[model samples]
Target: MLDMQRRKAMQKLALLGGGMALFPTLDAQAKMLEKDVPKWDEEYDAIVVGSGYAGTAAMLSMMDRGLKNVLMIDKMQYMGGNSSISGGSYAMSRTSIQKENGVMDDPEMHIKDTLKSGHNLNNPEMVRIMAYEGLDAFNWLVENGVKWKLFSRSGGHSAPRNHSVGVGSYITRPLQEQIIKRGGQQRTRIIMDELVYNDKGIVMGMKVREKYEFKFDRTFDENDNKTGKVKYYRANAGVIIATGGWAADPKVRQIFNPALTPDMPTTNHYGATGYTIEKLIKDDIDLIDMQYIQIMHVTSADEDSFGFGFRTITGGYSYGMMINPKTGRRFINEIADRRICSDAIFAMNEKGKNHPLLIMDVNGAKTVEIDALQRGIEAGAVYQFETLDEMITKFNVNKEAFLDELKKYNAYVKTGKDPEFGRTFFKYKDEYITIEKPPFFVTRPGPKIHHCMGGVRTTVDCEVFNKTGKIVEGLYACGEVTGGRHGYNRLGSNSVVDCIVFGRRAGFAIAERYQKMVRS
Candidate 1:
């Protein structure tokens, strides 16, 4: 039924400004008029939206401080936005990695990596707070259930302080479980349409509507079918926007970035839309670095799927090797910093007309399907072909050129060497592997521009800022919505670290605000 309505809505969508615009059709307008929006007259001490690492941390922290009236909200039926998809890596200081290895890393270096990575575009204050306070947050996550194992730092970083929570940010399940166990109120699959405003220009509550939610069936067919009424959550205490970046918003991406205009490569959740953020900006909310976007280097075997098990970040090997189609050869080292890798991928895609070529083993081809494919195949994220020749044909590469590329790669595989690019000897741990197996897999890589490094400008304590960089009263934001942590590109797993450490701080901070306001 919901699918029917969505299809109808799509049909009723009109083409305007060269894009499919979903303005209210006459039917929608009439339906909206027929129904009264839910009145959110009750004010809560605190309200936190989004269930990712940041949201969960904030929610849990608020409860810890006896802010029982708080409510946690999310648009997805399931909690944990990008946190669920994340690899759960955390950047910290004075940790076992540093202590055991005697690696001398301080907040200065972390701040430097963030600042230099962002090209100094990040907020210095927020960056400083993040770097200095990261160790505690990293510890908090491990205490909560986020397990840590040593993952070779993929991008450019000074030390081995990079720690992953075994599952990355996907531990949302456990975090949510903890939050629920604490008796915190959780409302999932409800879209936060808008923030309620008071006459004094302070935040009130929020207008929410139960929209599409994630329905997990082994069948895997779930959606937002409930044409529910809009509700409200009063923010008499504080409102925290934990909603993540806008990777799922296609139109917005097209408008802001031309390279991701079509089929380039991006790994974002289906629900990371910045709808609330857009509305907030329209309502005069301040933002930081809205223009600085981050792109990732993705390698998939086919046009349909994205390759995972990042050999650069993880030592996992897949069927094919990544290449720069323009040079018709491997270019920058895959283990190079993410910024360089992203630049190389975008340049190659733009130059090669978006058809990246891959070379893999015929035996490795077998690894391309089934459990090896995992969620990719079930989610239509990848496509498989029988032979390297067939895979080349699908990608529209020069057959002879593709064969020649494979010949050279195979020679290197037999010899334990890649002389052309020196990729095998790259610093990242996974560069040395042999894909001499059958059923070589090929996939189209998509850059995950999900976590916006730029968001509502905020202080380290997580206070939302105005355009003049002044703190907005009665409001705070953290997680992806409050950016300025990662300078340009966030190191893998670092964002989750920032979210939890800072999210806990935001919770305590907001709870204190509520207490002060109550006292006053």
Candidate 2:
């Protein structure tokens, strides 16, 4: 019996030893203590470590490319992460919508706008791809049942190209439906503990924690987590890290940018602590653009994240304007990119002034969806008044100065020029929007950490690279988790495009590589 048991143990060891060859470098140190073969609880062709736009896109793309048995996992109990609550703005150029809307835009213009918004630090090649293929991504979503309408003008783009849904759910829900329809699997509450790399330094899979509970009350420390059951998941094709950025992790944010204090709120979800990227970095993966955290400068002051209060500001910035509470005057260009707006707001906060007042007229309010707009009003994040005088009384504005500023702003609208701040105002139905219409809307807008412009480095094909500048074979990344596309500041509405475009690339690349390997 002893001899038979020994033989069976050796046979099991022989069968499992090669599987535990993942992360050879890290395992070598552990092997010094004990040589234990990791047992895999699940196996799939592809594993996507997020459930947002990028991860969903990757799964859908993989399934579309005939790669079955793809699984998407999220640490959070609910899927969609920050994407579920996002504004659902997708920027694309040279689309049917643009042509139909008679908006003059091309790929060159899109690329130029992206680069300019990133302060010329963006990857030109990635920007080129995003611009050229944006229409395809847009069409893909539409074909996959995303009902997007109403092109709102975003701040840095020269033309109106921000195609939006009422909320982000409109985009994520339909794509999730398509993912299920295509036979992809999605599991929530599964957190990645460590990436499993084979002896050749190729990523093979991940060691994960099932039923993981994210600690939201404490500072998010990825290494100190205690909950969940340990399990290993093997991915034969590849592992795509679309785990998004570290905006919600105050500690991570302050490490890269000290100005991002702990008190500052983020638009990202609590689970967007960036543990997956942190694991990769600890395992010697290269990270880039770590200092460029982006902030949304026009969010409602009362709201914790981009929820409820955001709908009002979206329309306010598009059609109305922001004015300093004390001065009752526009400080920065209302149509400027996020960086400029955020810096201006931060400067105001430093001076001990309240968050700036964002006000829009009936014409601007027309841009907001009726239901959401009503909800914002009911939540008290948005205040509505029948007249500018009533708005002044409600918010205690400098009535005379505010009226004078509006007069000047309305003049600029009529002439299609903003000489004071160089704002590029939008024209609705051949007429530039002005705040002269009745029933004004106002919200106190402040800054919130919105996006992390820095993360793991990836090629144009979305293949993650190691610190040695060599490709970590079988490792892919896309969306906000991998940086290179946006330079210093990401343009509004561009993140959605980034996720879908690169996510599709990562998915297709993994599928093709796996198919080739099988054929070979």
Candidate 3:
């Protein structure tokens, strides 16, 4: 029966052109075939197919480079795609914050840390650009009225250079406000529920369904089918695809990595589906590293409230430890980078049976903000216990084994050594806090589909490439839409910087091309 269904799906994909096989069902293909070719409703110098940090940065950079007419569109009703839902931390080096905090960091250090975290599979040129240009991008955010709360350390970085701005809105909101303030609102039009494309293997324009609503039902086959009045907007200069990754689509995720079944939860927004990628693939764009899907280690398993979304646990691995519920012992270093921790949890699952538990004391809880912890507790995503005994009894963990594990960890903390996993305490180092205080907190944090380290391959200049390694004219990509920046695994906080740095590159490149065309 499953084979029959698979055959039918393949046939339907063939009918609609094989590139779109990743769509939910054949109903979407039928809708596409039935839709009329829309007449151009408007034209612009450049059309950006997302409103996240990448798209916003691209549009703003184009405007700064004297390109007045640009259109930014998103399939969702609001702007700030997955970027707005992010932890609002950007990895940068040698910034004012780093200097103020008395931390010694530079782009060279950033580059080394990034390459090491990514296992050196990253493009050397792209890594250098992102690392070196990060400080400038940080200043750009500040110049545009975005403020950083402080500088802190994340898992992969060697220094306390992850600049935080509360949530993603701290940066996205300011960018939006600045766009509106600069009389660019007229030139910078944002149409919602629009999916742009390349026409006949060349950059052109987009097709949109205005005012369409997104039904949260994932099982609905016709969710992405065009419903409202369809319109097309033409672009004279080029089209920039910053439409993010395929983490949200189970079908596409499984197509890339078979182990990532539909049962796995994801931290991506609903719009993170790879519709744009499918469209680009149809245009002959090359996709690389599709199997390198990165999972985030902090996510809730509760399906009712904030399901699949991350809880803002402030202290991270520095203040807590991850324990195997079955053995009631620390199995992996909680402070390791996301991939290491996530892979460890996956390996320990033992035929996909159990999830690891992250436990912390009051001091660790204090590292996280009170409001965030309260929100998690109210949502029933986090649990608090008055004592170790209460926690052990509540979770049905082996009390003796759990206590022994905690005791062993505390001893290691006293000596500033994680002998078992070699967990580096980058921020606290010798002053690392012990998980001994009462009123302990615990949450089951499993891996969630987080990032795709692959997409339409691109050059360091943000120009998309074809399978033959030739540049696709008038087509640009950035952010998660482009591949080869962070080879196998992405370092924490580097994603935001990647979006901004390459976003500017794409913007400037497109603007320069547009000006040359005008001059000719």
Best by lDDT: 2
Global lDDT scores for all candidate models? 0.62, 0.81, 0.75
Runs of candidate 2 exceeding 4 Å displacement: 1-36, 218-220, 350-352
- Candidate 1 lDDT for residue 466: 62
Q: Rank the candidates by lDDT, best first.
A: 2, 3, 1
Which portions of model 1 show Cα errors greater than 4 Å?
1-42, 97-106, 166-170, 211-226, 262-265, 299-322, 325-328, 350-448
| TM-score, structure 1 vs. true | 0.73
TM-score of 3: 0.87
After the best TM-score superposition of candidate 3, give how far the Cα of residue 493 lies from its true spot, in angstroms: 0.9
The digit string of per-residue lDDT tens for model 3 on 372-400 reads 78878877778898888887777778778
Whole-model lDDT for model 3 versus the true structure? 0.75
Ranking by TM-score: 2, 3, 1
Q: For each candidate, what TM-score against the reference?
A: 0.73, 0.90, 0.87
10 residues in a row with least lDDT, candidate 3: 25-34
Model 1, span 1-520: residue lDDT tens = 6336434433443221211322211111111110243565556788898888888899888888888877888877677877777667677777876787666878888777766665554566666777777777776666776666554444656566667654544467767777778777888777776666565556666777766454422122122234456666678787888888875565555555555554444566667664666666755666655544566654443332124523321332223466544445665555455666666666667644574444444444433334435545445444455665566556665567545666777677667676776654322233434455555544455444545666777777888876555676767888887766675456655687678878988899999988898899
Choose 2 or 3, whichever is better by lDDT.
Answer: 2
Q: Candidate 1: worst 10 consecutive residues by lDDT?
A: 25-34
Evaluation by TM-score, superior candidate among 1 and 3:
3
